[model samples]
Target chain A: MSRLRNRTKFMNKFFKSAIVGLVIIAVLIFLHFIGWLGPVEGLAVRIFSPLQQGTRAVSGQGKSFYDSWLKKKDLLAENSQLREQLKSNQIDVSRIKALQEENELLKKELGFASESQLKHVAAKIISGVADPYSQTVVINRGQHEGLLKGMAVVTENGVLVGKLTEVGDGFSKVLLLTDNKSKVAATVQNSDRTAGLVEGQFGLSFSMTNIARNQQIKEGDTIVTSGLEGQIPKNLLIARVESVKEVESEIFKTAILKPIVSFADLSYVLVIIP
Target chain B: MWYKYILWSIVIILAAAGQVFLSSSQNAIMANFDLLLIILVLLVNLSSFERVIWFLVLSGVIMDIYSSLPFGIFMVSYLLTAIILEALFKNFFTNRSFYSLLIIGSIGVLVYNLFFLSFSGLIYYLGGSEYFTNWRYLGAIGWQLVNVVIFLALAFLFINYLSKRFKPVFLHS
Candidate 1:
């Protein structure tokens, strides 16, 4: 009889629980269908949310009471991280652009490095300090690399830019061909092979003098180093002949030569060291 | 009798609102703390089943009204949490020290949150909401857990303190 009562009690409990569970489920389903949660929460929040704030205020410091939800610091941290990432990305982009420019410069320099007889040291143009009186540039290589005074400073395209005048342990200075005191022995690259002494005029242009009035120099004639008798090498590019002028009273004709390379854009340079 | 129930209900509602306020004001990468759950865990553990069961129901309904979850979702989760806890905490704990209360509250918040989040997700799936919030599982859960630890400590301390110093005569001595 007790066993029967136990079974009966068990059934009764099961049925009751099942019924309660079903009722709960049905109510939840109806509420969900009606979408009443939003309004209810809104009203509750409008009425009671302040109490939560009050609770926080009373619990401790403004910080202690707000507890885990003072997430401004977290957001600030995330903002900082993202900002750092963006900064790094920007740096990488600029680095890529610089590398591309260097690659192009190196590709142009490859032939000069290989075809030249003299050993070459690549140096970056640290600065171009040209005044009205002289045009000079500082390079990153110096006497430590066996760079001596009077070594030819040329661009990647074999254009003779300057001659090294002074050297230090870590840097050297180059006197550009455009400097007033600069002098170079050059020959016009025509069939006539007219030779002349080129000298700088006002740190701007070079005047090639001592060419005979009858020399076969013309417009756009290429001028190169005569390699006559100095530490300078032959075939070093100087400039192109812009115009040849002749005066009846003068013994030799003059040609105004325009430099093939621009000084403002010079970055990478090769020092031709003997 | 039921007047105390009304007072407790008011307290629970206010606490829920304060949590909501804090969550809204704070800018975060989805790091909202479950303050309501922490408060409920304290209440459930401290109050008797007969007296607090109705309060739990009212609190759940209030939370459901306040929450973005479906109407019955928080209601159901709160009810289930109270029921489960009412049975589980019966005579199991006597120590009400600061550390003991904090540890117990942490475990309670963890369990309640798991249930709440799971039930809400189930309801969301049933509701056919197209937005699948996978982000909530990763960083949000971690931050929420941290929140649970910190908030539980505070909630347990505050409620435990009040329950100690300000006991009415009708309450257990």
Candidate 2:
């Protein structure tokens, strides 16, 4: 009789608690529906901000420790050799001059970056998604720092990295170009001046299609952002053409590109604010 | 009574933070085991039905905060998954066996991912999926399977290791 009473009491308590939990969940869903969750999300980011930074730091230290411990002597020898090569290369100034001449030739054809008025804010990328499934990173800048959604983010060398998709008060998330869902309007910097839509495909590579069949594009041509409608600036270097596929029956051809800037090595970027 | 829940909340929040950190740093994408799933499965095997339900609520909240998707999508999916797992646990499955653990983990992953993707697809479509629907989720699901295998093996080892002195107590409970 006592055991039965105890079991009945537990059941009653459980049912009451369950109802409370359900009500709580329902309230949260309603709150989310009305878009009152941004402040709450900002709070969560604020709380986890230190943890995120610490994780990044620890991982960096661990990697650096492993590298130095394994390659100390070898790195010293390579450093001396590199220093010697640098002295010799400094005397060979003509090599840089020739590269500059080739760069100017490419720019003359594209006719971009001459009259560009650049407005940018610098931010350090605190952490990045290592998974190939989604390419995103959390940066230290946010609404207080004037980061708005759809702002174009680029590297120090003016290479397009991604755009700000979500921004909070203290943090923001960037969506990378290599992400499988990402799409960018790009133009080829060649004599033909072909324009196409670049789309990420198969989690591993990108294919830019929609080029007219008669447009002439070489394998080694460079591709840059179309900068359509003044949101994302035009002529930001995107990728270089590795191969082009043309089907006579189709109106559009596709170009396989090798992304110029290495996404893996990115640690900082400048957000182009409008 | 609610103190244990508070403690578990702290633990889950820390685990979520760790999951975010791990996925973000050193490119450890291959080792991206779902820490949240591992914790919930352990609780499902060990806790009462009502407790699992509450934990699911907590799980949903954490995932919503951590994920970039709109709020409550994961919360709803997790609540449904927890109820199913609870039903299976309370009436059908034994918590003591290795095979049960394996089966539960595998099926749980499939159910959770499909449910999540369904909700995601709906929300994104409703919001207009012009460029948002090209994710390679099939490949990511394969990776999730690998993660499940690894995490379950470790969990089993942890449980078996604890059986040294409290074998009967640990196994039965």
Candidate 3:
């Protein structure tokens, strides 16, 4: 009788503990779902990011060796050909000086964006997303680096990728432009005209939505952010049109675009924080 | 005895380090081992139900700390798996049957995958329609299948080797 009673007591305690454990789990899942648990996500990224960095360093060693040993011979020949071209072009010094002045002026105009008050933070890509299914990348800048959630992330070439989703002490997560959930407001560069939302599709491609079929859209048209959200600065190059589709029944045409930046080859990025 | 625990701990840490560092840059063919799962399976086979339960909790905590997912999801899944396996061993079969062990381990892997998918689905539903799409679901299925197959092979080899090499220590205990 005593042993049976003890078994029942143990079973009861187990059941209660299991129930409590499940409840706690459900609540944590709920918090994560709603984006309230950003700190936990950041912590996870920080803990695992070192492993990713170490892996990349080890793999890159072999590539560096090959570059120095095998690629150097070809590079030297190409270097001399380029040097000869430079020597020939030395006669056009006056014309080159004029072009450099014009180039600097254009850069000054481009840099003088309306959101000049927004602070910019530079970051380096430490690792790609740990899980293949998730389109995220870890940057070396984080909360300690003054990065925050909703900060716009871009390449050094000024192409918008995504925003900071989670920020740790020394690292931040950038939801890549290829992620299905990512959307950015953009405009066509040719006319400075047609504006629509740029939605990322699978395989690193994106499609511009809400574009009218009759809008002066065409192949090779450049896309830039409209800065409607105020999260991202305006006129940043996003992509170029690869193809366009128009349907009579539909109100808007869809244009498939190739991203301006190759996300997979990203080594450095800039985070624009307002 | 204390030294043994220390050795196992070192092995577990090294395995995690390898998984994180070495496996990330390697080809998919070579990145097949889940060292944590291998260690957890070994511990389950070598220890009693109560001790296994504690180890499951510990492993789940470590995984949760390292993973981007929610904290307690792995804990619940690991504990549930441990309990089910323990119950199966106590009620139905002897541990000596290699075939039975394999079947059980495969089933456990399937269950873990199922739990992972369901939890991910739940997160999708709760978060928004944009959280998960058709292509993402397909990708998840592919990755899970690969994980399951790799884990099955690793578990089988480890069990076979351990049973042969440490028969007196593991089987007798």
Writing each residue's lDDT as its tens digit, candidate 2 over B7-121 gives 9778777776776676555545524576666767777787776666666676567566656565677777766666566556644676558888777777677777778788877
Report the number of the highest-TM-score candidate.
2
lDDT of 1 by residue, A138-247 (tens): 56677669988788889987899888865644666688787766788889887888999888887667879899877788889899998983778888889998988899
Which has the higher TM-score value, candidate number 1 or candidate number 2?
2
Model 2 pairs in collision: none
lDDT string for model 3 (A1-274, tens) is 9978976875675556556555655665565555576566566556656766766666667556755788888999999999999888756789989999999888776662343555688887776543334566678787777777777887765678778876765777787777776788888987548988888786367799999767778999998888787667787778899989888899999999887777656767789876
Q: What interface root-mean-square deviation (Å) does model 1 yield?
A: 26.5
Clashes of each: 6, 0, 0
- CA shift of A92, model 3, Å: 14
Q: Rank the candidates by TM-score, best first.
A: 2, 3, 1
DockQ, every prediction: 0.05, 0.19, 0.11
Q: What's the distance in Å from true for residue A236, model 2?
A: 1.7
Better-scoring candidate (DockQ), 2 or 3: 2
TM-score of each: 0.36, 0.72, 0.64
How well is each residue in B1-173 modelled by candidate 1, as lDDT tens digits?
87976787677666654444444332232125666666666765575444344555565565444343444555666566656554455435555557656766676666666777787667546753322324455567789899999997677667766777543355334
Which residue segments of model 3 deviate by more than 4 Å?
Answer: A1-50, A59-118, A190-192, A210-216, A247-251, B1-26, B30-33, B48-96, B128-173
Compare candidates 1 and 3 on TM-score and give the better one. 3
- The local lDDT score (0 to 100) that residue A111 gets in candidate 1 is 69
Report the lDDT tens digits of candidate 3 across residue range B1-173.
99977785655545554544323343444344555555555555566555555455545544544343444556666667666665565446556377767766766666765676676558656863344334577578889999999997677667867666434444333
